[model samples]
Target: MFFRLNMKLFMFFLAWAFALLASSLASAATVEQIFKVQNRTIKRLCNERVIVTVNGLFPGPTINVHEGDTVIVHVFNEAPYNITIHWHGVFQLFSGWADGPEYVTQCPISSGNNYTYKFKVQNQEGTLWWHAHASVLRATVHGAFIIHPRSGQFPFPKPYKQIPIILGDWYNAGVEDMEKALAAGGRPELSSSFTINGLPGDIFSCSQKGQNSETFKMKVKQGKTYMLRMVNAVLELHLFVTLANHNFTVVAVDATYTDPYVTDVIVIAPGQTLDALFTANQPIGSYYMVASPYKSGGKMFDNITSRGIVVYDHQYAQYSSSHLVMPSLPSLNPMMPFLPPFNDTPTAHKFYSNITSLVGAPHWVPVPLEVDEHMFITVGLNLQRCDPATVTNDTCKGPMNHTLSPSMNNESFVLPKGRGYSMLEAFFENMSGVYTTDFPSKPPVMFDFTNPDIRFDLNLIFAPKSTKVKKLKFNSTVEIVFQNTAFIHTDNHAMHLHGFNFHVLAQGFGNFDPTSDEAKFNLVNPQIRNTIGVPVGGWAVIRFQANNPGVWFVHCHVEHHTHRGFNMAFEVENGPTLSTSLTPPPADLPKC
Candidate 1:
């Protein structure tokens, strides 16, 4: 009798499990679409929009999928330029084919072309995003992708509700216009403010006046908790985010759970995502959800550009006299996150250092030795001239290097030094700070930001320089240090690496001594990061395996600084381990 009862229970459990599996499969969402990124007239204003988006919207609709299910996204490009999509922070690790980034792993889809991205959803149940990866095309093409748990395992605290808060910056002048201006060596004007979900601050009023903004408003019940998945979609800005009248606890970042960090304000940089739990337990009221530039001493031009509003209840309108007071936040101080050592043992430390420093090793073989390299550069900021034109023109009229500028071979980076230059020649030959490939493997270099005893032009002012005929090889196992010279800007520079994440060895002020640094390097363990900040007037050492191919961008992560020409690219040639098994671009590849 007992055996019979056990058999019945086992059969029942199997049946229930099968039923659930069937239902989940049945509910799997499908997104079949062809989207175009183009300029269209919205309300008679020539607004740049992504038309023919999923179901015909500017931003393709949010894609909801369950983990362990297959996702098929068929994209067609009707736009003028080629575009590619990356499902950022998604756990499609083994499915590298569908993990997009044009020219990195696959080619972009050209205008009047189509491409299908298919992969299994093996990521943790969390908030994720999708954006275009073409030459900075994310400025217009992006949307949210929310993955639910197939097994009902929760990644965060279950709130009464949930919402995705995508943060993006808008340049109403149009992305193509910005790109054109930047390429032209002129300032690409920007919108006065950032937007929340593509909506500006005064949406209701703006709408009445036939205006459109990106700000999004949320209504909540008193005494309820809400899960906010805040995604930073801005290409370059690191934002300091906060909500008036309420504090939040950050539960996750980049889809990884963190020890709950409670704070009144949160700082999130580009390429970083945060999950915060907010409470609406206060008296029925309204408050502004605000985001501001995280850099310090930013010019005091005050305008409420980064904004959203949260209403506690319907009665908030009745309390017309009540003003939602903004909370006092800790002064923004950019500091490195405290982390555990990467290689604790001495042997492991030595091995790690070898991986970073050894040329021709599997780690470092990819970085190309220059066959015909142009200018190598060291970039930073400096003080400004009292005159506004000099300051803006980067003329440096005062005594010494006035503000942040790019330097080549210990000289400032300058552009178009030749006389009687033609437009075509300037486009290719007259770039500032041009250099040859003859840089030494380890030079005794010095950087003094506090005070300059020696004077140099802020920009290179000579003929274009190119690399020597010989190549300069670098070991992947070795560490590269960047020294920041003096600049008027008090803020530090963010170092971003391309192709691979690197271990940040250490950061300190003053010049770098190769022999001393090599001996003292912390190879045993270091913080692994994709972007790092080299403190003002200081130096930062980064270690990575040069494993990826093609040209990769390495630059100061500060958007504006980079816009001012403080960046460069590295070539990672295929290495021995790089297999001939590598695939070629698809037939629909776009030509830029």
Candidate 2:
């Protein structure tokens, strides 16, 4: 019956190379591609800045594959800095070597060097992506990874076309400069502009220190449905996206199929993706596709909308108009559609909580009934003492001569310096002293986590920095309650895992109560995702089966937070048999 409903789409795209995805269905394919990491002088927001990019494209080339195919990619680093590419949302079954994070899986592929990553995409089919895993490079070195199901396997409403919209930020300075500024324990510089498909749209002009960007446009025939796969690739900001007066039937998220959710606005955090289908049932003229920052507390910069135009083919116009209709969102910029206020928590919560996995569908994984390991991890910003007498003035930029650091379970994660081996390398070769498997399952102490008026506790303000990981048994069912705290201030945190997608059981504001929150868990059909944006000063719960044996990094997707020690890893022990264990590292793995 599912096949019967989606057969039209299956056959429609069987030969149609839509969205520039040139793939065949004779059999599962072996996709071979090369990514050249280099720097290019690009003019954006009235500045000619040298930005590091993959293949010189702001949003690099798309990697299109099917569900059961193998992917082999060679990344040659020509940029001046070290880099590593992460295949986000890919379940790296028996292929953890290719799960790239700077110090988790492998060291950085140094400049003038290259590394080969080989993996397979199995039992997953939808929108995923790849981006630079080190520092703020992901702002430019990212692209879409669309996985199409085999013929007759697609289960969704038939759409006439598919579109990939990559939402990002624009900065005048180079990414390294921004990293250096943030390393001083201060807030990073503000983004000059928000972008849609690499453009900040025409509303912004270089005369106002903004880029003269081309607005992305989607041309559609009247009455035809189109599927748009949207990715939030911003450095630290969450985005609120809407297509003027159109309604969307959201079908998938983070490569997982979901129950069709109809909504007008899309709230996407960093490192998240959404797929929605909309019909061109409106008038013949063009409409605005607007995106803006959905910031919930924190500093503000260039609070504006990144836009695109939705132009319908007027040849067969049913409701033709002489002039185009514009969206009615409240705008900071004149003649722009921008209604989503910076702190629209209710809308964001609705979009995040209402989504559920399309259970009983093909290739759906059921929620594990038994939990072998349960954890309560606190995610928050802490302060590290920076003395004027001992350290330079540059390092003491945080409040009260303290640098802004972050932590999980009150233990600030300090990744091992590239000292000849990554954590995975040390774990694989029995090299000791690099990392310890002692990450705690809960915070050391309890307090009013989200209270802003209470005097801050000195111990809570500073997490003892260390490199610690939680050890998990192979194939163990694990549950985690991620508590978001307000040490310095409360802000949304986008937590991402490396090798596996977890079931988002529940999310709420303030502290997490075990008894009451456990009752709210959606054990039947929770949304499965690799990344989740825990609410500001709130908490979220997730569960996953530690079936893959590897060293997987779990960190905040807001890259600057990861740099500030908001990260940890899981050392899942080897499975019982050879087939279930992690494969040996490749010969050309990068050496520190």
- TM agreement with the true structure for every prediction: 0.62, 0.91
Local accuracy by lDDT, each model = 0.52, 0.85
Identify the leading candidate in terms of lDDT: 2
For candidate 2, the TM-score is 0.91
Deviation (Å) of 447 in candidate 2: 1.3
Per-residue lDDT tens digits for candidate 1, residues 110-177, read 77777777666653456777777665566557777777656554544578787888777666555566
Evaluate model 1: give its TM-score.
Answer: 0.62
The 10 consecutive residues of candidate 2 with the worst lDDT sum are 327-336
| Candidate 1: residue 83 lDDT (0-100) | 72
lDDT of 2 by residue, 1-592 (tens): 8888699778777757642353344235789999999999987766788999888898899998887799999999999898999999998998988988997899999999999999988888899999998777888999999988755355775688889999998888777779778878878877888888998886766633323436676777878999999999888788998877688888988989999999988999899998899998775567788898887876644587788878776555344367544433323332334467878988999999999999976568999989999999989888887766955677778766788879999888887885678999888887888899999998998888888753256856887789999999999999999998888778889999888989999999988988898899999999989999999989999999999998999999887789889999999988999998888899999988
- Residue 410 in candidate 2 has what lDDT? 87
RMSD of 2: 5.4
Which parts of model 1 are misplaced by more than 4 Å?
A: 1-33, 43-60, 66-71, 90-108, 118-125, 147-150, 203-215, 297-304, 314-446, 449-584
Task: Give me the candidate number with maximum TM-score.
Answer: 2
